[model samples]
Target: MRNLWNLIVQYHIALVFLILQGIALTWFVGSHGYPRGKWVQRSLEWQGKWDQRMSQWDRLTELDDLNRELLAENATLRAELHTARRDGVQSTYQGAEVIRSTWNGASNPFVLNKGTAQGVKPGLGLLQNNRVVGRVVEVSENYALALPLINKSMEWSVRIGPTGPVARLVWEGGDVTRAMVYDVPRSASFAPGDSVVSSGFQGYFPSGLLIGKVADETPEFDGQFLTVPVTLAADFRAIRYVEIATVQGRMELDSLANSNGQQAP
Candidate 1:
């Protein structure tokens, strides 16, 4: 208290001038209509801007919550759609967020905020906005590792169109938005905008799930087969929320295939 008193005494002249100046300004504004009106207007403007900023902050919080709800709803709908497509196809679909992902690597891998505890397991398929994104390759208690379509080491079984021939979709490691389908028959009737869908032979994704669209790039001829380019439907660079489909009979199918001396996809 003594130190504060000494400091105030040292700045007494400046403090007195500031106090008188504030009093004079207040009196001037209170006595003059124009100044009083301008002061009120400035105060209102500042308050309005503060209110607007608060409203924006509230909207951002609400938007995040709404997105989470929408993601969960979409996951439920996708699960129902898949169930309705096949009889006795017991699958559980859950919503997940991509916590980490890489699209610029030769073997792009992603991490999802789900794990064995959340029913996530190896061989499960991942989808974003109803489009095939990737498959879960490894799972732990609280996380899962997935390989996206951009991975050069991964190949997906896809068809050119609804009734078109099935081919092997593989990434060539250059463009993140595009992939190549090899062993596609030269006589396959498809145009630039034809859809490429999952063949379901791999037992990872459901049949007819959209993988990509046939790109406008020129096809390369490899003898009787054509290597066609495809524009992927899932945007790896923008992956946020995803749906994970857990096929119930996948293990059984794998077991049967192994007993028959065959590998399941």
Candidate 2:
């Protein structure tokens, strides 16, 4: 305590001088009109600049959100138009992001960020890049599970568009861009470049949903039918956005089909 008193005594003169100087400066500024005005002006200028910066920051944040919304809306519109022109059915489309997907396995599935809450349901057709991608197999309130066309367990009844045989679309356990169709009659016309689309006979997707084009044609191992290799129209390997094709009256159709043990006519 004595040592502290000694240090205080030592610096007392300097401290007193600083205090007096601060008081003199304050008095001089307050007593003068120009200095007081200058002080207030500078303070207001700094505050104005700060407010402007804050406003700009807010606008930038809003722009970021708006950009994302616009992109999503654009995807939905494009998909809707594409499906309407090709499918020729009473259907609507909703946009969704592929939150999870796998393409290198025997039974790959896709998880999307849309579900029942967004009007998504099982038996909904999924499309990407104007082509059939998959169908909704399961759903929750905010998400849905899909079986992409590349999955082994996924088989869609498709036919060669413009007078071709009805066959089955199946994955051969490899290749993301290619799959095969079986039961195509050997006598069916084999063109180098042929188009394939959904038959819509299974009541899952609308007809004329472009599946792919024939890449190659050859005889199956059993030698009874043609194993037609197809180049998929939709690229599932890097899909980011997808569209849900909600067929109108799906519930009634499903109920009737289930009751009859047959597809809806």
Cα lDDT tens digits for candidate 2, 177-208: 98888888888876646788888766667677
For model 2 the TM-score comes to 0.66
The superposed Cα distance between candidate 2 and the true structure at residue 135, in angstroms, equals 1.1
* Model 1 CA deviation exceeding 4 Å by range: 1-60, 85-90, 263-265
- The 10 consecutive residues of candidate 2 with the worst lDDT sum are 32-41
Candidate 1 achieves a global lDDT of: 0.78
Q: What TM-score would candidate 1 get against the native? A: 0.74
Q: For this target, which candidate reaches the highest TM-score against the unseen true structure?
A: 1
State the C-alpha lDDT per candidate: 0.78, 0.73
For candidate 1, lDDT tens digit of each residue in 31-127? Answer: 4212223443344345434544554554567776787799999888877776787645566688887766777777777767677778877789988
RMSD of 1: 20.4
Where is model 2 more than 4 Å wrong at Cα?
1-88, 217-223, 263-265
